[model samples]
Target: MAQQQETKSEPFDEFIVDTEDCEAREQAYRARGTARPITVVGNPVLHKECRDVTEFDDELARLVDDMFASQRAAEGVGLAANQIGVDLKVFVYDCLDDEGVRHVGVVCNPVLDELPAERRMLDDSNEGCLSVPGAYASLARPDYAVVRGQDAEGKPIAVQGTGYFARCLQHETDHLYGYLYIDRLSKRERKEALKQMAEGAPRYETVAND
Candidate 1:
């Protein structure tokens, strides 16, 4: 999950997660048990493109459930499969938009659509990743997006959002292509973000959330 800017100190606050929902999810995960450990920036799994998900079976269903649990446990609004070291084109999100509408679901092998350039709104919000824990940098992303994919059951799924949810969709989709939120940073910002990670982004064991 990428960090979002939720303060008025930044023009990108619209991209941040809802504080109340974040706490609620964390509590729910705590009650459920443990969360999966998040893969850090240095991990090879985070750098390579993920394989498409083909087997839509009980196994895929279980994986999606675990992903949702893991994301909630980490107090993140969205998470990609690779964030937990799974090299599959899948992601789970439980996020809110500026309107406070909750959007939750799983996306496998997603195809993203960005709004036309003239209609696109760029948000330079502060974004952080679970893989690069504790480090955050300003990133510009479109304010509206649509993603078409399938559910764990292979059913077609299409999600579209504005504001923060839009950012969440794009961020998670990028993970499938082996790109991190940091990769969207400007050259200078990317350098700084790397430095921050080098200084030590917190590392966690790939265990279930507690």
Candidate 2:
């Protein structure tokens, strides 16, 4: 019998995990007992472009809390609303080290800004999603990017990220656009990776209608 994997704890404070230590962060995600089925690429909620968040009340706060809870429960670095079957432009991230944990925040209505041309491409990195259970794939992404959005408190903000945060931002933003980690790979790679992912994974079907 296979050894049972240990699940991560909740109320993620970012202080416990150092995101700057890529190896350690990856290990944390890997340690997550199992991958949970996140809404897939063609799911109507994922495909239907999310609307800009307009309300900021207790309800929204609760949703934000739940998003964070889900991210922690899934042991993911970032999470988007669409992945959870909600068609809304909302995402939460905590890409920092134990010392720099406060940088983590939510992005409401995220819009990508001009990334320095020199920083556009990055080496392929292993990526996974909550929606695609038990699937991990290497995906190529930019090393740096600029994102503009509003915070949970409804304040406008612009942030620039490099390294892991940049990669995560791109991935989460892709979720908002109905793209999955597999879509970032080359056609040949996607074919092979997806085949392997589907073998032991639970069945998932794309939603036919948006």
Candidate 3:
């Protein structure tokens, strides 16, 4: 998957709808808002394993671009292909904080080479996603992680993350494996979060998937 340079002025064409599914897809995409649930609970696209990335062609490149757009549109820091109903082992991360800085790259055909046998946990902070709409929770995750994966160019790359980046990587990786952030939360927390989801908060899932 080759990385495409996105101009600040021009909109991303990757996730945009075409003449075929414009109305339905565009409307469905718009329904997503910031409050959308992270798809942590209820029939999540987990269990089904994702295939590895082998080719880095035009389509793969386009998909990466769309993933970035979807992530940004959803106001998320990272996203995986599986979250958008594509069972490919690809994810995009914006190396930015909540303050809206941008460090960009694509992670393709990722392989989780290492995880701490003894995990280190952190506080449950608000987390959301583009798959499930109008939901969020203070989910717990590890503080550090080392992931070995391939870049868009098919080069073997290993990157270690700490702090929020580590947490975001783990969360997005979980999406690749069909896991949701809610799965990592306690039963009580899930109940509360689901309540907010039911109330229909504005979130990105509706916008991206629509």
Candidate 4:
């Protein structure tokens, strides 16, 4: 997804990395990943909360790899499991913060961290998603976000971000809990975003809802 702000990673190890290793780590995952069709907004899987990742095994690792592949293929900054029709609580992201520093990593069973007033500063910007392709709407989200979750191997990890990267963290986490960025928009804006998607199709293949 484009930032209207700005812009995954190691095996089950590196939870989050800065600009220096972001590209290389992301590439490593993408190289082994196979891009799958992104599921659209109306798909049933996209509408419901995803199941927690109970078993952190090779299968889960492979799913993370595939999510990275799909994110890159669709040119999105972040992607969640349900976006690809998987009902597991996981997502991959490669996004840049306000300072232009790129970050990449994976979060499984992500839970958002509550912020005190100081860190609750809001960032309002146009946001897009791979699922609701070709659509964007202005949304306000906490500029600084912290998400706690396990990695591919069930290792505890917490990721923190600011600016667009922060939005990516919150946005993807919401997907796991069955909420799209559009869902947070006002009724009119939500309608307009859907209209935008109808007017233009995404470049990548998407699952057609029944």
Best candidate per TM-score, number? Answer: 4
lDDT string for model 1 (108-154, tens) is 99877544557478988888888777779878888887777787788
User: Candidate 3, 160: how far from true, in Å?
Assistant: 1.9
Sorted by lDDT (best first), the order is: 4, 1, 2, 3
> What is the clash count of model 4?
2
Q: What is the alpha-carbon RMSD of candidate 2 to the true structure?
A: 11.7
In model 2, which regions exceed 4 Å deviation?
1-37, 96-103, 201-210
Taking all chains together, each candidate's TM-score versus the true structure is 0.79, 0.71, 0.68, 0.91
- Clashing pairs for predicted structure model 2, backbone only: 38-130, 38-131
User: Per-residue lDDT for 38-61 in model 4, tens only?
Assistant: 999988898899999999998988
| Candidate 2 displacement at residue 37 in angstroms | 7.1
CA lDDT of each prediction against the hidden true structure: 0.76, 0.64, 0.60, 0.87
Q: Please name the candidate that would achieve the greatest lDDT relative to the true structure.
A: 4
Candidate 2 lDDT at 57 equals: 77
Report the lDDT tens digits of candidate 3 across residue range 69-119: 566577777778876666689887765433443335566765443443354
Distance from true position, residue 140, model 3, in Å? 2.6
Order the candidates by TM-score, highest first. 4, 1, 2, 3
